[model samples]
Target: MSRARRTLSATVTLALACTTLTGCFDESSPHDAVRDFLVGWQSEDYDLAAGRTDGERAAVRKALANAKLELDAASFRFKIKSVSIDGDESRADFSAEVDLGENNPLWVFDSVLPLHLVDGRWKVRWSPSVLHPQLKEGQRFAVDTKPTRRQPVVDRNGASLQRPQFLYVAGVIPSQLGDKDEEVVRRLSAITGFAQDRLLSRIRSSPPSKFVELATFGRTRYLAMKPKLDTISEITTQRQEQLFAPDAPMEIVGKVSALTPETEQKLGGPQRAGDSVGQSGLQQAYQDYLTGSTRTRVITLDLRTGKESALLQEWPGRENLSVKTTIDRAIQAAAESAVDQAEVSALVAVDRSNGEIRAVAAKGLDEEDDGLAGKYPAGTTFSIVASDALIKAGVKPTQRLACPAERTVGGARFAEAGQVGGPSPTFQENFAKGCVTALASLARRVDAAALAKSAKAFGIGQSWQLPLQSFSGSLPKLDSDADKAKAISGQTVQVSPLSMALVAAAVASGTWRPPVLVTEPSSPDPTAEIVPEPPPQPVALDPKVRTALTAMMRAGAVGTPAQTGSGRVYGVAAPAGDEGSRQAWFVGWQGDVAIAVLARNHDPAAVAGDFFATLHDPS
Candidate 1:
């Protein structure tokens, strides 16, 4: 054979052998296989990732199935920094960035993936520890949360608003009583003042081993029924610390209860059953701040060995923070005492100087906050706004206007309650007497928009960003003369007790300042720190208009023959038979304190007077 021919044949044969070797093996290198496996795992494609594992496919699938520590898969990202291979074995190092949640801290970790050769092909060595160092075979990840202790709610003076009091919980243990359940329930009802049928139903539906709660009673009632209740075997009593003040305002302080499904869903995090949460009032409004923080831990539990170890994630619990309010205890007590007898009533007091709400009290009302949410026609109390509008319209308080027996406008008739028209009465005189016919007569003389604008100056129908949910009065558009007349007499306009209190405060301070309840905290912790809310921009009142409104209020409080006194009670009352219910309101300021009292089917002026008298003399 020739030398050239032999050399060319050997070169061709070597080239062909190299080509066959390349084609026989897969195109993906060891690094590429590892990278694809990691990508599949990050994307939550457990089946695709498991396919890359040799003997640990079942273990990898089990780990994915048992993973309870849910994280946003999209937020998980990783990049392979380097891959080193010796023979058939390879090691790939990568950095991973994991997102937890808004309330949780972000996680960053570096990990190494080990690959091995099996049957001349590289395959990932799957293990639970690949996901987390602490994980083991038959181990699963879970998050455990520990909630912090509840904080206290304080008044302006820093005194605890929720006092430690005895609350009698009446419940029945079905198994303990056996056949005596019916008799015991009957006796419990007779003593505890609960319905017998309700207790019986609760007992009947409950399991034999469980205790079913029926009702809770206050200290006085519990003490009165203790003798009879102690004799019943099925009945049990438990005393718990709750918000309780015999004379403290109930509606403003509010109440707490077990977490409802709605609140749990709203909370959107780990919360245990039977946890006490605020349901209404300021309690519900400041739940985040008051609830504190919960400790969260990601742990891996080995099902086979029954051993558990914490993963890389950990969130330490935070301390509870107290919520300090601007409520004055003395004023709240006085307001509560004032409305103790009224079937439906509310009283609110504000510091005229800084617009700090001092007291909020309501009685014989539903669970909803009635002190700031109850909508009622202002009746004659709205004359404050009308008087301001009239003055701004160049109408003097002394301007003579007719007060007839009755006047009809737009088919809506308005009449004077007590006195009929003998002649013409000055605007100030009719205002003091609360003459609806007189105000309605001049309704056509003023613009309704101007009236509403003037009312806004007194903080009526203004939106307020307060911590607690409140209704800051609302004014409907009045295009017709009759609507304007009704609005002027405070008939068509609806106002809350808090709104009236603010009106009186505006009249006294000559500037409308939104009411503030929570005092800003000085804590360094971001969670504990109270974000400073911008103070409401004050609305200035015209000096001339302010002076006229003040005089008119004083005149109304002192009756027809004006009497001189340090304390002034100025407000208006509506006829009992006119609107199916008697409504009255009195709003006035004494020194730096401005207060409003609203009563339904009762005299509000008298209630305001009594409240003031009690304020001056608590005896």
Candidate 2:
């Protein structure tokens, strides 16, 4: 039986009761009894309604209570349409409206509630039909659902990206569980919503080698629950890998996880369990467009006969529509193949012209998005900003700068990059070669305010209208000379791969616009809110600075690893650390596409090289 929320009043007045019925003389009229009974039933006060009914009051109360669950009702209302009275017997014709769950149509019908006068009072003679006209004795209402087929999330060319993700069992190796068995059991029961006794029994009868499966989850669900299970040593879980490339693109394309109850309630009402649902990425962002349409059948089941006796209502499910994205299939495939197998690496490619993010791929699903929002020192990538500042200040790309092994500016020495000097290399050449000390020396040319202003112009410390979560480059007030030096060279700066990709796009294209992952959010008219009608234009860079920066990057990529064989791609690759052990970079594009490959602990130049190589090659 469903829990009655006490939403309706239990009392009824003689005037109101007599209006619908023909004969009623006073408050003691039998019409008042029928009124009270109908009011109680409509309000879901089962006990109050049952008391005014005759013939096995408890059984009648139960049938009334069971109506909500049997019909999966969101709402139930009863109205007295008309009544006929004959001596001691009366027939109350009422309108019954049983509302099924969300997306399904309402079930409406007319039924007669029988009543009789006894000892100067009237009572509703309750029967199964009193609850629902079709429901007979020992029959209940039931619902049947046809699972929605998920449509594939596609790329710019309409290539499918949706695929089956692995299911993981979150359980314990019986022997390895040891002393924490009780703790594991309790936690698993809570996580899985399984009964405690049933789960405890299963835990007790499991083999050591065979993992005692407690609960199975899709990749998205398992990853979400992994943190909660970390402290429990006995709770063992196998890694959930994607069938493609060790894993499907999660932080970008998104993944399907178990349909959670909390999410279900928000989606309208409780839905059937064990269905894979979009947990994040485009799958979640465009949930309404992807799998919102559903088919539902509402019927009255003959509980004693164990068969559906009548069809109360039917709502047809429509085919799920596909979600077209900004991702390029070729670029996504190439970038996925280029991710470093040894370390957590990420790549983000965006259109330089309009800032449409074309591809995002990552290896190792870490807590933070290493590809999109992961924050790290920008390394030599900061040179792009420094170059912007210096070039704007009349510093030419061909101007020869100092060749220093180490520099002590503002009392803080910057010797992190060992030595990057090549026979009086030009400022642009040194900056392109991942120069550290030279950049520190050039920090004297521009003050902290100028640097911050230039960085801001590059979209640092800015908000994105984009849907995905990302970290815009952070540039605090450059307080001291040391701060200026470090910030100029990127030793103390924090940036994400996505933010850097936009930075590269700013340099590649004349202007920098916010990134758009979902190209076609809505069918005919794209979502005005997400896709922004009259889309935010790319912030234009200074013409002179853009020209100088472009040429410098081309010159810098001369013999560097970021240099592609096609030579159509021009970018910079730089690493940073005390002993150069912390290899990091901000590498991107010169053409229509601007890319960023982010990683910590190793230089991702090789990954960047492999990515560009694929783009230039014809399969």
Candidate 3:
């Protein structure tokens, strides 16, 4: 033949030979080939071993290197009892005995490897390809067979929210399908909501091996369907010795093994199968604390008697700890309902004595998105900081102040929230009415730095360092005339609803406490006595101005807004003629509690009408 024809002929001959011996070649029975290859290498017959494929030869060489180390460093021997071939695979069940020459036998391992026959010989194959190369000649190793962990969740009430609801369960032996395999699968499929056809397909697809189907949240529905399906036929019932904590609902149970498929199937279900995890709300926030630890033990079976006694080593999973939150379920529900009526509204209730957050509700808004975590202009509420700064600067509310519609600082003119395009009122009147003009004029008197400092001390541009994430509302630095002007205008700073609540909380409690969502405080678990943060440094306020502000806020709540048609909570109406109805709010302390109510699309007239109507009807 010519050179090209000769090359082609040789390739064709090699292909033909491979095709002819395909059945004789068992890829799964390569243990002897592995052993022979390793021996050849140990005897320095590198060329003979190198004749095998690269992957197979590498596996042998690596095994030999490991075996050599073990033999030299310790007295470890894999006593092979017998090697048998059933079907197309080879299983070498061997005992690993160690002499522990200078070490403990525990450091050595005994393992059985199932190899496949390929190309008239056997080759080892790992189900997951990654584990194949890890096998060292004569080195004992176990295969990874189960599902890994997924993200866990829980409610603010410390309830376990998410868990494994399904399983890839199967029982295997070295013969025909286990007895009642069909019946067992049908029942399992019924309980697990697995399609009968799919279950049968999986069982038939893997001839002798057990079938594993990963379970999901739909377990409850499947479980409910189990009994109906179990009536179909007798299914294989293997004595499964699973040593792990079953997903229990609101109860702690002891560890059990060798449970029935029905028991295990039910054990795998969540509280409401797929309902345990946090689909929305606080469950999503504290996922880590809710997911507990896991421990797995796989027992070796006594094939003949169907007994599982060998104690395989246990691998521990992280324990999912319970986290208690500060949320009150009842109050949360009420607040959610009340505020959910508006397009946008937030309510925050806190203990006035120590700043413990009682409840916070953001209707139709995300706490992490456009809710407490986001920033918005503080509106007239920022007047608290401005008034404080101005008071500390020796400007009293009684001081007659020129209130103008517009004020210029650094040549930039700013307008008030509600101005009739006329000169503004006195300091007291401006602060009472939440006028932008009067406050802007006050901005000209106080230096920017002092105002900014006062705002920070009042919980602006800072977080309370809550374990749960919170937004640090930004404050405008007023170092110069321009800065002071913007600060007074409420234009430079960005505030969030949560930040606003914190500010109100600080004023209410005379201190700032970080907001907490986890039911259990990392420190001083809730089961114990409650402790409060230290008191805050006092902000100097003229008692008169403070009283005036408090009175004015009250007036806006049940008085000013009430007269303008925003009715009072107790039926007492103030002197009429109050104009705008911008989000009527009632923020004040009753005993040791500080409560704030924000209403959207507020119309004082309609509010007052409804209030009076309710009182008249005594409903």
Which of the predicted structures, 1 or 3, would earn the higher TM-score when compared with the native?
1
- Writing each residue's lDDT as its tens digit, candidate 3 over 1-619 gives 1223433543554355334334343554554454543234434354454343235555545544433332222222333455677766766554544221111122234456566656766654432111222332222322112323333323345543334334323332313545665666556565655445434433332213333332232334435544654454433322222212322211111122222334323433211111123322343333333433233332333334434434444445444454454544444444455455566565555554555555566554544443346655565566666766777788866676566556676776756546432453456566556565566666668877777776777667653545434565677555677767666656666665555555555554455455544435363222236665543443444455455555544544443333323333211111111123344443343334444444556432233333323323433
**TM-score of model number 3:** 0.55
lDDT of 1: 0.67
TM-score of candidate 2 versus the correct structure, residues matched by position: 0.72
Error of 3 at 552 (Å): 5.3
Q: Which window of 10 residues has the lowest lDDT sum in candidate 1?
A: 65-74
Off by over 4 Å in 3: 1-213, 219-281, 417-426, 466-469, 519-552, 555-591, 595-600, 603-619
* lDDT (tens digit, per residue) of candidate 1 on 1-619: 2223433544554355444434543445676566556665655567766777775677676565434123321144555677778888888787766543324454667887788888877787777666765666665554444555556678998887775654566676655776787788778767655556445644543334455556566667668778878887667787766544322554555566544334444654333332456666666666656666666665555445434545557778555577787889888777777776578777889999888989887777632366777777787778888888888898898898888878897677987746633587888878877788887877877898889888888888777767666777877789899888888887778887788888888888898888877774432233545665564588988999989988887777775211224665554444322434466677777777788777777776666666676777788
**Which candidate number would show the highest lDDT if scored against the true structure?**
2
lDDT of 2 by residue, 122-182 (tens): 8888777777677777666666555565567887888677655666656666556666777
lDDT of 1 at 217: 61
- Where does model 2 exceed 4 Å of error? 1-36, 39-48, 54-66, 74-116, 125-144, 164-251, 258-269, 284-289, 297-320, 341-344, 364-368, 416-423, 447-449, 522-536, 577-581, 599-602
Q: lDDT for each of the candidates?
A: 0.67, 0.68, 0.45
Root-mean-square deviation per candidate: 14.8, 9.9, 14.5
